[model samples]
Every structure is written in C-alpha cells, then in structure tokens.
Target: MSRLSLFAPDNFPLIQPGQPLLPAIVDALTQGGQPLADNDILVLAQKIVSKSENRFIDLGDIVATDEARDYAARCLKEPRFIQAVLNESAAVVRCVPNVFIVQHKLGFTLANAGIDQSNIDPSCINEEHRELALLLPQDPDASAAALRRQIRDTLGVNVGVVISDSFGRPWRLGTTGVCIGCAGVEPIRDQRGQKDLYGRTLQVTMPAIGDEMAAAACLLMGEASEGRPIAVLRGLEVIEADLPATALLRAGNEDLFR
Candidate 1:
C-alpha cells in the first residue's frame, strides 16, 4: 500500500524582491522542524514567485492608450489596470462590462491577465501606488528550474517545484488551483493503450498530475488571509521528468474554445 502526505512548514516572514528564496525556505523548514526530504514536491503560490521577481507594477506609472481607455470604459475597469492586463495578455479572449478575460502571455486563459491587487502589503499601498498589481513570473518554468537547482545546490536534495495560481473555468462556479509552472516532475501521465478492468484498451487517457498536486496544495493555501504559501507533497512515486507545465496546456489547434 502506498501513502501520500502533504503539509506546510512554519510560515516565513515577508519576502521581498530579489530575495534568495531557496535559502529562506531551507531555513524555515529547519526552524519548523520539518526538513526537506528527497523526492518531496514543493508547491508554491504564484504570488510569491512573482513578488520575488519584482513583478509589481504601479498603476500610476501607466498611461492608458486610446484603445486601452476604450476597452476600460467598456469593461468599467480602471484604464491603467486594463492597460496592464493588455500588456500581459497574448490576446484578449473576452471583454465586457465588469468582466474581462484574456489568454495570458504564458498561454493560460485567465481573467485580467492574472494581475492581482489583493493581499498586498500596505507599504506599497500609499496614495502614490494605490493600485499596485503583481504580474505573474515572466518565465515560471525557468523560475521553477532555478529554484530546483538552488535547492539541490543548497541541500543536495532532489525535489519537484510547482508554481500554482487560482483560476476560474468555464461552467465552474469558483476558482481552483492550477499549475502555471513546474520543474522536476511529470506534468502528465499518459495511459493510452493501458488495459482497464474490463480488459478494454484505453485509447485516450492522460492525467494531469502536476495540476492535481497544485490543487491539493491549494487546499492548505487558502485564497484569502492564509499565510501559508507553500506545501510539501511526499510519497508520490512520480518519475523525474523535464516536462514543464506548458506540456499540460491544450494546444491552440486542439482547443475547441478558441
């Protein structure tokens, strides 16, 4: 019988831009009496990765273009915010009053280009930067890889890293955790041609294990006011792979919605 375990270590202090995250994470795990183990999967909130990369954008610094202003007026959103969304989006999927959805630069279809202002510290919340928004990491897969390498270099442990964010889907009522970046993990488990209980060969079956891990971790990292931003998943007999979260995205040619 196999078993799986998931737990968050003691919360660390606020992280700043350009901070060395791997060392801090290791220190926190040591202080919390939960050290990193081999094959442990480290699931992290996307917000922290973005913050560490200094992806914050001040709304006051943006000057809305004519098209952005027009779109903002139609959507009833701040012009600068809309501009930021446009900057981060590969293409606008839908735009309407009080709602805007887009294909993020990272190829994920999300609302407002994933530019979030909630749960931000007050230090950047003064009048000058009242509408501060954090952008997703520019290259999340790279971020995950770098973090993985750092962990290996610092602790000599092999572990997986996943960067996740909350996303709302079509026909879904609320948000759920979704993987945007991953490293040292197999993002998908293809089970094609595998025999089922009835001895029927499966033609198409692919389980997104990375997204599942992200969702499971999300349960501990609540959407609002939850200081927990990291979780370690253990006992997953996942074969080490070089697949990124992008491997899990349905290609545009295969997407029916587009």
Candidate 2:
C-alpha cells in the first residue's frame, strides 16, 4: 500500500489582484515548514490565480446586448452579468433561473463560464467595479506551466502544479473541484490493456488523476470561507509528467454526450 501526505498552510495569505503568487506560496510553505520537495504536487485554487492575474470584471464596463438581455430575463440574472458571461463564453449551453451554463472560452462547459461572483475581494468592489465578477485565467494551462517553471527556476525543485475550479456535473446536486489547468502532472492514467487481478484485460480504464487531486485539494480549500487556497500533495506515483489538464477533456470524436 502507498501513502500520500497532504499539507496546507493555515495562514496562507489572502490574495489580491496583481499579487505575485509564487512569493505568497513560498511564504506559506516557509511558515508551514514544508519546503519544496521533489515530485510534490501543488494544488491551487483557480480563484487565487485569477486574483493574481487581475482577472476581475467591472460590471459597469459591460454592455448587454439583445441576446444577453434575453438570457438574463429568462435566468433572472443581471443583464451586465449575463453579458459578461456571454463575453467569456464561446456558446450558451443552457439558461435557466439561477443557472446559466455555457462553454467557456477555454473550452470548459460550466455555469457562467466559470465566472464567480462569490469570494471576490470586497476591497475591489467599489463604485468603479460594481458587483465584481472574477473570471478564469485567460490561459489556465499556460498559467500552470509558468508557475511550474517559476518553482523550478526559483527553488531548484521540480513539482507538479494543478489549478482547480469548482464544477457542477450533470445529474449531480453540488459542485466538486476539477482541474482546469495543470503542468508537470499526468492528467490521465490510461489503464487500457492492463491486466486486472483476475488476469482480465481492461479496455477503457482511464482515470483523471489531475481532477482527482484537485477534488482532494478542494476538501481543504472549501467552497465557502475555508481560506486554504493552496495545498501540497506528496507521494503521488506519477507527479512528474509533462501533461496538461486539457488532456482530460474528451474530443469531439470521443464525446458521447455531445
């Protein structure tokens, strides 16, 4: 049996717009007394990354079009907010009261294009940025790669990075954490053609490892007010790989639901 250790910083500082995430992570790790270890997987909440990237939207700057207004009327949401979602989305998947699902520009089919209204820094919510909405990073995979590179270049230790976000699943009641971006991590472990204990060969035995880790990290990084946005997972068997989270997504030919 293999054992995995997870560590979280109790005092991981609250991130602000334009904050350098590396320094904050380093400080948290220092305070926690867990220096960077080889093969360690760093799981990060996507909100902090967006915060560091200053990916907040000022509602006042959004101009709603006819389509946005129509969707807002049906969803009972603010027109500007809907417009912002439309701007972030590639296409609308569904629109209903309290639910506006769309395919994000980054190809994630999630509610509101994964644009979150909760947990936004209140200080940035002012007259200029009315009812601030936090957006996903422009390029999450690139963000993860950059962070991984920075960790290696800065600390001389190679670690995996996974950027996580909450996602609602079909026929599922609540949201769970999923990997939106990753670097130096194996997104999927394809077990096809592998033999089982009974010597039976597996055909489609792929598991999303990155998403599994992200879900575990979210257990510590709670949905509401847990304040732990970063966690370290050590002892994963394949923590050092050159794969991104996009590898987990099903292509058009492989997608059965579409």
Candidate 3:
C-alpha cells in the first residue's frame, strides 16, 4: 500500500539567519517518529532556503531610482523593495497599474521574482531593524545539493530534496509551489510509449512529480503560517541514483509554447 503524509511543524520558532534548516527538520521528524522512509521526498519551501542563504532585503536602506520610483508608484509596492526587485529582474515582461511581471535572471517568469512582504515582521521598520523580504537564491540547484549532502551526512539516510517556490501558472488564477531545485529524485517520468488500460498508445505523457510534491507541501506550509516550512512525502518510486530538476525544463527549441 502507498501512502502520503504531510508533516507541519507545531508552533516552531522563527528561523534566524545562518541557522541550519536540515537540523531543525531532523529534530522535528525525530519528534514525529522519523516519518521519512527510503525513497521519500522532502518538499521544502524556498522561503526558508532563502532565509538560510541570507537572501533577505531591508527596505529602509534602499535608494529608489527614477525608474524604480515610477515602478513603485505603479505597482503600489514599497519603493525600496520595488527597486531591489527591479535590480534582481532580468527584464520587465508585463506591467499594469498594480501588477508587474518580470523575467528573472534564472529564466523564471514570475511576479516581482517572488519577493514577498506578507509574512515579515512589521514592527521592525527602523533603520537598524528594517523589514525583511526574501530574494530568490542565486543558485537554487547548489542550495539543494548542499542540503542533500548535509542530510545524508547527518541522518545517514538517503532521500530526495526539493527546493520550491510559489509561482503563478500561465493563464491560471492562483499560485502554487513549483520545483526550482531538486536532488536524488526524478523530476519527471516519461511514459510516451506506454499503453493505457484501453490498449491505446500513449503519447507525450510526462508527470512533473517534483512540482506536484512541492504544491502538495505548500498546501500545509501555508504562506502565512508560522513554522512548518518543510513537509515529507513518502512512497514515491525511485528510478535514478542522482536526479536533478533541470531535467523537467524543456529546451527552448523543443517547447511548443516557445
């Protein structure tokens, strides 16, 4: 029998900069009878990854440029934070009165490159204690690899790790977490040549299992919830010794949408 369980941490303390997330997760899992089994996937929220990597921005210290001020006025965002977002974005793809779409350097089409201000501390508004907002990690793949190595070395267990962030789908209303980085698990499984129950040939069948797991985890790890930055997904079939999320991305020439 295959089963899936979502683990949400209970009243966990705020994760400070330089704090290790894997150890915190290990402690939580240990308290919960170590729910991770072989082939299990650990779906992690990218906010925590960014926090650990010191990817936060202080809104008080920024000097908004003319373009940034214009963007801030249009987007209704803090001028400093909007400037930072602009600096991080490769190009501004779309812009409206309060909505701006940007293509990040990492080739992700997202709103403001996922810079958020909803969950941060509002009290910290002074120069010394500026409000913090998360920036996307410079290299999400490397972050996943380092975390995977730490987990293997510390827990003596082999499992898959996924670093995920909330992203809006094209022509979709809401946002869901998608796998930006992954390790030790196949991100996609191609079943194009397989036969269905009706004996019909299947074509172009590929499952984005990594993104699926990320969305599932994000359900429990709510955008506003305190703690619960990690979730464990069990009972997934393992087909590779080393798997990376890049495999899920289609080449520009191969993509029909492109």
Whole-model Cα lDDT of every candidate shown, in order: 0.88, 0.89, 0.77
Cα lDDT tens digits, model 2, 1-258, are: 989988888867888889899999998998789987899999999999999999988887889999999999999999999999999988898998988999887878899888888888766646455578899999999999999999999999989999999999998799999999999899899899999999999988998998999999988878888889999999988646677788888765677987
Candidate RMSDs in Å, in order, are 1.6, 1.4, 2.5
Q: Per-residue lDDT of 57-158 in model 3, one digit per residue for the tens?
A: 776667899998888888787678778888888888776777878877776778987887666654433457656787887888778888878877877778
Q: After superposition, which runs of candidate 2 have C-alpha atoms over 4 Å from their true positions?
A: 125-127
Residue 175, candidate 2: Cα error in Å is: 1.1
- Candidate 3 wrongly placed segments (more than 4 Å): 122-127, 241-243, 250-258
- For model 2 the TM-score comes to 0.96
- Best-to-worst order by TM-score is 2, 1, 3
Instruction: Specify the highest-lDDT model's number.
Output: 2
Candidate 3 backbone overlaps, count: 0
> Relative to the unseen true structure, what is the C-alpha lDDT of residue 245 in candidate 3, on a scale of 0 to 100?
69
Residue-level error in angstroms, candidate 3, position 206: 1.4
TM-score of every model?
Answer: 0.95, 0.96, 0.88
Cα-lDDT of candidate 1: 0.88
Better of 1 and 2 by lDDT: 2
After TM-score superposition, the amount by which residue 59's alpha carbon in candidate 3 deviates from its true location, in angstroms, is 2.3
